[model samples]
Target chain A: MKRVLMRGNEAIAEAAIRSGLKCYFCYPITPQGELVEYMARELPKRGGVFLQAESEVAAINMVYGAAAAGVRTMTSSSSPGISLKQEGISYIAMARLPCVIVNMMRGGPGLGNIAPAQGDYFQATKGGGHGDYRLIVLAPSSVPEAAELVGLAFDLSDRYRVPAMILADGMIGQMMEPVALPEPVDPAEIPPRPWAVTGAKGRPKNVISSFDLEPEGLRRMNLVLQETYREIERNEVRWEEVETEDAELLLVAYGTMGRIAKTVVRLAREEGLPVGLLRPITLWPFPYGPIRALAERVKAVLTVELSAGQMWEDVRLAVEGRTETPFYGELGGVVPSPGRILEEVRRYVR
Target chain B: MSVELAIPRGYTRVFSRPAALSEAGFTYCPGCHHGIITRLVAEAIDELGILERTVGIAPVGCAVFLDRFFNCDFVQAAHGRACAVATGIKRARPDLVVFTYQGDGDLAAIGTAETVHAANRGENITVIFVNNGIYGMTGGEMAPTTLPGQRTVTTPRGREPRSHGYPLKISEMLAQLDGPAYITRQAVFDYPHIVKAKRAILKAFRNQLEGKGFSLVEILSTCPTNWRMSPVEAGRWVAEEVSRFYPLGDLKDTG
Candidate 1:
């Protein structure tokens, strides 16, 4: 019921605290340090644990420990930092524990710069770490959505017992926006976890491990995980179909790019052109069905990204040859202006 | 008269599986010293009566099987991250006793930062380190703790200090730190050594139980399979050779 103007990083941190985040551990990286700073200042007052770990690797593993102890846990990092945390993230996935990871992404391919970029779309959607595993990834276009998704990330992580990532970019993390914060969910509303390692008091020992020596056992575990993934895909595909009815042109985007595409659509429409937009919210389960069905009606689809065609591949696959798919992007954190996106749209429509 | 009044106290069961050591059978290489050290830690936990409230973090090396062996609530960490995980568990719930069982590769090599920082912060937790001088699970690779001139799969020509650098004396190094409440290096080769190692382990655990902060016991263990020797010969080597590079005793003890 409270309305406030907050930065995306601050919104995420405050929302996590409200969501009953019992432990927050991370190292500071640009674009996302506000989240860590906020958590460090606030979590202690809430009787929660806050630690600035030695490294990204250590931070993720700390989340693993606290999550295993049956508490809400999280960590935030940038591109390079996230790269360092891949091993721990993989282990957390293998261990099947619920935790939230925020990647306020910066330009990369190797320390590209501390600026906005969507280069990590592949890393977030696809498996960044080793093995057959998936992280639930949500991309938010606004500060309010960023705050809302933090709560959703925790709920989805707890519901599925999997790690959920809030894939925000540098622009969203640093930009200020007006937002009405959601009411914090009560801890009692969270699903019960009998499997957490609290203590062995009168109960059989609980072993949380990713080590399965036998191939049969390991393969069976992957299959079970895949089954859960299938359930997630079936139930959790979220997207926005903006004015798609009777549109001759379709533009696909997400995160900061999604906002830019919205302006491009309005510009194209004002110029007497029929253009629409499809914005994906969940990056992993990529709203593929919606994109495919939309492609069936639209004349052509073009994907706009802040990186050199990272999420474009998924866009191509989702369209499935129903129409020609073109891509527009700027690498090294050079975000395209709406005018530039409108030009790309004009090439395909009217 | 003493025997007549007390019904022979020795007749009572003196030794059994500690409540911390679970019913699961440990599957380690024959003669590997990890099993012995695992039991010592469990025995320490049992003797202190902290088994009900203790949380054990297992490593990713040969000792990863600790998750199965230790009966208390356990979480398995990625290679070399056990100390960081234990730090998290302890900080979140100080009421819960937390400890980590780590191998040389996991502790001194890959996880050196986590190990050192956790210690430097004076975290109230226990660490059980097994320095076998080789990476046993990965089939005898060179470890950070491998002795000088020691032969391993990665160092077929023997460890050359010029290229490979000298073996890391992690225990000695950690002993110099100001954060540790207790630091010791013990061996588990013979009966007397085993007794001393168990005692050191108990001391480390007791220190944490009293909230002393950052106690570690580095047990100079042996990997007979990796060393290409019989279990008996491995025990002898730990006594004759391993003890030279990693001496036995309390390198540093606060209490």
Candidate 2:
């Protein structure tokens, strides 16, 4: 497809439609409103269902329903709205249903500001809702990447029967960039979901449920989910490394903070500093292996984010005291300029 | 006296389990109305010949295990979210039949917003609202539909309107909306009421088949074990006491 300038939210919506999204349900929230509007206008024209639900709770449940019916479905929201969706997300996870969810993160603890933030790292990577379940969390750094990751999210979610999420921020959601959108996926080419509750015609009935009153049965189900997650961890860890060959200082970030760190890397390199960037694309099955390997050779790792060092905790776990791990973060939806981040890199780079 | 009669010639079977229902025994407590309601729904499905393409959304209450007793496909939704789930199913595959089986707490309390909005949107789906006055599976907790002075585990002091608030008549409230095509409050307290309740359930499914939009049948049922009463007493309570607060008749039918 030809490259076209599109807002991050519009690009994601277009990408999801191309990825064979048959049902899209959402409620309006800031920083992601354009995504909903795009789906409302474009999805129906392409023969898909677009429903603006009564609330975030209802929207996620609608996604649950559509996914259970063996269709590619999705829902998007900002922070507080995402919190309301946690319960339904947990249900979808337990049922082993495949669906895509996009969270254009804004400031939060309670109804936080509409500015872009990376505060939902813990909620996205870790199990936000109650249960021993994990979603395939993908972090995208730019408009094009955000659009591309939506397709990957759907594919991984369907392949594993596990829900996948696009963990972006308002910065990416609102920013406009030229993107060569992915080719539309043929709905007929999608894999069959035999377990989905389509109907009982010509076969035994299919039941999509998370309720197992028996303790032993529930335990076995959890074990199966754990095994699938382990397989995903083995095969799906993704990251991007920039000039890490002979660098002594490493900068680790993702999403909006990641793109900013890329700029910091360029400026630091010009100033005779050996600073490399390690950006994780998948936040759940985080790129712990590559970070651990690089930490052994580097003098220190500086973690940058838009929150109070949420992902920094994961970096520390990967480094495991093998090297010094410094952290720099800007909370409350503040986006630090590359000049400010380069100064932080100057302190750590030998 | 136990007597075994020989099979008479030309004797025809009149009633049996609905084909849409599985042969498995129900998990409901004795005299609980879920079994009867389930049978009615299954009969409706069978009568309409939609068993092959019908999808049922089971709620989180006693009917949580509803998948086991149904021959058709079933999706067990979270507590109070069946209506939203049903909307998803029906919207995604309009040719399929979708229905939600929800209890009072699931429908009138936690899921009030989902139920009301789905009905208000006039989503083409069938909703079986089983109002048993109290939460059965959760041990007789006070439901939104719990009558005043009705003693439940949460309302042991005899529900006072000042603190506990009044019973929520959801069917009437939903009937006031323009979305729902058919909204009715029925009862299964006696033989005649049971027959009428079956007809109401059948109509709800039929309305969905005719593409008339959202149809909900609120069947006033008995929860004997949770109500701390015998089967007969519980049925009597639903007929005499519960029926007074929640009138048993069609609130609206847009046919």
Candidate 3:
């Protein structure tokens, strides 16, 4: 283990290298460029492959290629660049190639500014790409969590043979923080992939493909993907529940907003307001069970976000008809401060 | 007495023997050039003995099922995205031979940016372009490679320069770049033309094997089904009308 003061983006690059991912392909985009730069410098030093592809479209396809070749690979970009990658991401998911994608999200719809925004919540958690595919989305609130989740992402991706996304906002990517890099996993010890395209000599040719035009064959493939997602929902639901006991108002948030909401929770506690925070780590297999449980104990569930009520929908679903759910959010890259959230908590508590 | 083994007619042992292609037969109309070009490329891959190490990207359009015929690692890319996908494969595993098979609409229209930049960056990959002057898979619509004054489903009254624009000379544009190691335009309409196309295809693949930069082979082909012409007439049209706009020859050869 090594301790280093690193920016969130650098931490992610370092963690990816430590996770035994040999290839990092990406195109430079705002806020997330540091991640690609770090990999470009560090990967070669560590005897890995790093390339600046022609565009986000190419970078993602490179990830698909490397993953199909049975090497751990990744690509990172901001919101607009990620939209360009959706096509490649769809193919990766359809092919069942295990790889990681990092979206250091910024405001969007189209080139909506470089400031941090959770506007990509739906794009990341729900399928951003076309088709009936879901990426295992993990949102990291802190630099350490961002670093730690890289390894976890590789594990989950390979285990399930599906793409995993590390959904971070600009704040998490741009902020500096202390992080202890996890111990390096031995690459030799990892299980061998029989499907890798490593020159099929003395064996049957290994084919990596996403097309099954036959209706029955396509249905079987879709069923396999669905079963894998169901397993993920059952086994990988994770969240942080803070001070839920005797709480009158429950706050649901994630990623950077959740971190800010935690501060509000602390302030509300000091003010004698009974409030709790539920931070969802896995945004896709969203920790709804814990949220619903918290909603049962509280009078109102306040869903706070940096986007215009994206995650609020999930909160409503979890607490459907069970309790009153209100949304408080800032749109177009405007992030709500802890004070604003604390005030909202006070109103909900009273 | 010693005897030499002879290969069967219309079959070459050097080619991968068409295992991945369906015996149920091709979906292409008679005289369609796509089936021939596909076979030629597949044969080249077999001759190079790189079937396992090859990753073929198939673009949206007529040849989307190229994966089904190549028997290699195949990925279907969005319309005009085969080049981008091929760039990805090449960058990820330089050891693997990555190639994209694309139609005129895919290569010259929506994917133009990707194709131009990939070549400009001197990406170590091969691009196999099939130019039939019209969108064959989409009801004979006019394409970026569609000739001036030519009529199609979209250009029923004939293509006008003021509205539809002149056909783009992609091979010439690509050949102008110093980054690309090889660029050639060939047609598969006649026996001699097929021989020329095979040589161009071989050179493009060889450049990648030699660690040379970008290479492109633009094949002037026929779309009998979409062009609403007989297979024989379509072949003749490729030789006459298409060749006049896309002249067949080596535009650049760094090697």
| Top TM-score hit | 2
Which regions of candidate 2 deviate over 4 angstroms? B1-10
Worst 10 residues of 3 chain A by lDDT: A198-207
Q: All candidates: CA RMSD in angstroms?
A: 3.4, 2.2, 3.4
Residue-by-residue lDDT tens digits, candidate 3, A71-159: 88899999999998998898889889899999999987788988878999888888888899999999999999999999999999999
Give the worst 10-residue stretch by lDDT in candidate 2 chain B.
B1-10
The digit string of per-residue lDDT tens for model 2 on B1-255 reads: 223465579997666778898878899999898889999899989888999999999999989889999999999999999999999999889989999999999999999999999999999999999999889998899999999998999999888989999999999999999999999999887889889999999899888889999999999989999898999999899888999999989999998
- Candidate 3, which CAPRI tier? acceptable
TM-score for candidate 3? 0.94
Query: Residue A128 error for model 2, in Å?
Result: 0.6
TM-score of each: 0.96, 0.98, 0.94
Q: Model 2 residue A332 lDDT?
A: 92
- Order of candidates by TM-score, top first? 2, 1, 3
- Regions of model 1 farther than 4 Å from truth: B1-12
Q: Over 4 Å off in model 3, which ranges? A: A189-191, B1-24
lDDT of 2 by residue, A1-350 (tens): 68999999999999999999999999999999999999999999999999999999999999999999999999999999999999999999999999999999999779989998999999998989999999999999999999899999999999999999999999999999999999999888888999988889999999998889899999998998999999999999999999899899999999999999999989998998999999999998999999999999999999999999999999999999999999999989889999999889888875
User: How many clashes (backbone N, Cα, C below 3 Å) per candidate?
Assistant: 0, 0, 0
